[model samples]
Target: MKKEEKLEIKLNVQKESWKSLWLMARRYGMSPEKMLEQFVADLTCGAGSGGSDERDLAERWYYRSFEMMGEDTFVSYLCSDEDMIEEVMELKGRITKSEQYISEVKKRIETGERIFVHYGKADKKSLIAATWEELGYESREAWDKECEEEIREEKEIVSENEERLKEIWENFQRARASQSATYEEEMKKLDEFLEEYGKSFR
Candidate 1:
């Protein structure tokens, strides 16, 4: 694919199960990641309906039927008047510049380049601080404080969502089961009444 080519592509994506993505990836001689990007591009680049909420629509188009691997996100666009190549390069530069902080702060994440793993266990903050120190800046007390607060907020949101979802699902199941039980009991009573009426008629 030329970095500067502006062309429309149509891609058929197998949903979150990722079974079809893997197959397409192999067929295209590219990684599953590359296949997924092509799939998202074709979907969100206005090749088709493009749907509402492009990002969510892309996720659905790619994996609604499949199990979620994780909640990764993507952003795509259609070039209106600007040069697409320049836009792509500028976007890439923006991302790379942000990521440069990773090497300065931490390295080799998951065997490639280390990542700052702040799962927010008690030593996580210290490790992040050390990464900043390596980058020739003492980890700022203010920033560290902000990070801790942010981490706490994240934990609260996750915990709240989990509880809310669980409560709603449990209530749904109970309602279903209760209705089933009531229906069965009613059927049993109807059958008994019919048996008595038949005996009287005889």
Candidate 2:
């Protein structure tokens, strides 16, 4: 085997591209050189090829990060699965309805509209109502009590969604950790291969 020589290449990149690369390198806790080298190695060996499962996982992680960063204007990668897409659409519809309901309630409160509630035991029910009358009416308290259960349920729904988001974030973190571990193992293998190859020329 002939000895292989290492060559240094100087490449020009846009400032924004450089910044993005730097940020990604920092995100992975890697030096820019190692980060770029690994990316090239992965690309060359088709480890990050678009059709590969690993690439699909990486793409999902990419979109998930964007979603976490509030750039979720587009459909999520998870939505590619028919079942997941249906579930997400349902949740989104429910969330939209909840928001509209809350907004209407707030508008009604602001406009001093009357809110009515059924009070007393089931056998002795009476209709009670209240509004924000100018003479220091106690309608606000009544209104709050009237909607207390509903408000609590809404809060619980919001909390559940938040917990789900947190779970997704944790899953992404685990996936990222696994990818990093695999990358390190691949780098080690490449180093070993290069070392053996170098010795073959001696």
Candidate 3:
């Protein structure tokens, strides 16, 4: 056998499980460490569709698992490690502002201070009876203007978040590429070490 390069990973398991794994490893004529390495290799080894890389395959599995658990899988997959902190703070700020604005609007509605316009030729009594549209021209105009401004502000908020999300996804893609390149380099070095060891034994 060649002197293969070794990689170590730490896992937390119950004492009984560890004992069982050691027994199983001995039965297979290998150490527990080698057994665990083989297990991990078998679990992760597969050719993804359309020749996708390991990172993409791992991401797909992660997304599927989170979705099965009824979690916000899109948010989980969208933000890179670096983006999460900054983006979450920004989102929280936006949410706070939105909540305050909504509270103010609710207060105005409760106080009957918001404008409601009725343009039909109704008598004063009829106009007063109208539920939603019975305000004077000036009040109606003010309400319409306020609504338009609110809509524009809402759109701007959405657009900004959307752009930030796009940037986060781009950063994640680059990080994945970098990780994949590193993995390939490590594998190549391991293979070379194994080949040299085999030649030395011969």
Candidate 4:
């Protein structure tokens, strides 16, 4: 194997700026040279190319400090609880609404109550009594029309609920996939950081 040539470069900056960099390096629990090397490497690699695309320069450096940290630990540092909570609440809200709607539909079915149009009748009893034979409806055709209307509405609700369920499932899956991708990217960055940090220590 061929050995790569190493070059030493000296950077000129204001004392205050160097002091700030030194402070940052100390905060990162690494030496100033290692930190500067990382900065150069990061800039060379292009700043938002990795999974941490959303993060800024300072944020990336902060995360680099926890190179050996787990997702749970990284998550705490990232303060992603608000995002997680929002996702959970949205999912719960969707599920609760669906459950409540189903329960109401079941209750109406069990009670034999009118869920759709009243069809000009005061109650279910009157509606049923108003059939063709009872003359409550002008004709059998009129009664069938009302029945068809109710059936159409019931079908519509069923279709709407099916669509709603599908949407909820799709949204949940998308959110989960997004979270996984973000985590995977973060883990990749951590692995790279750990490797670099190890080299710096050696």
Better of 1 and 4 by lDDT: 4
TM-score of each: 0.21, 0.35, 0.32, 0.27
Report the lDDT tens digits of candidate 3 across residue range 25-122: 99979898876565445445532222336446656766677656642223333333435644644554565576566666655545544432224454
Instruction: Report the Cα lDDT for candidate 4.
Output: 0.54
User: What are the per-model C-alpha RMSD values against the true structure?
Assistant: 23.9, 20.2, 19.5, 17.2
Per-residue C-alpha lDDT of model 2 across residues 18-100, encoded as one tens digit per residue: 88988889997987877766555444444334346545565666657765664221122343354643444445446657767
Superior by TM-score: candidate 1 or candidate 4: 4
Whole-model lDDT per candidate: 0.46, 0.52, 0.54, 0.54
Candidate 1 is scored at a TM of 0.21
Cα distance off (Å), candidate 4, residue 16: 23
**Which ten-residue region of model 3 has the weakest summed lDDT?**
71-80
| Steric overlap count per candidate | 9, 0, 1, 0
lDDT of 4 by residue, 7-30 (tens): 687788999998998898999698
Ranking by lDDT: 3, 4, 2, 1
lDDT of 1 by residue, 65-93 (tens): 64454221111111122353243334434
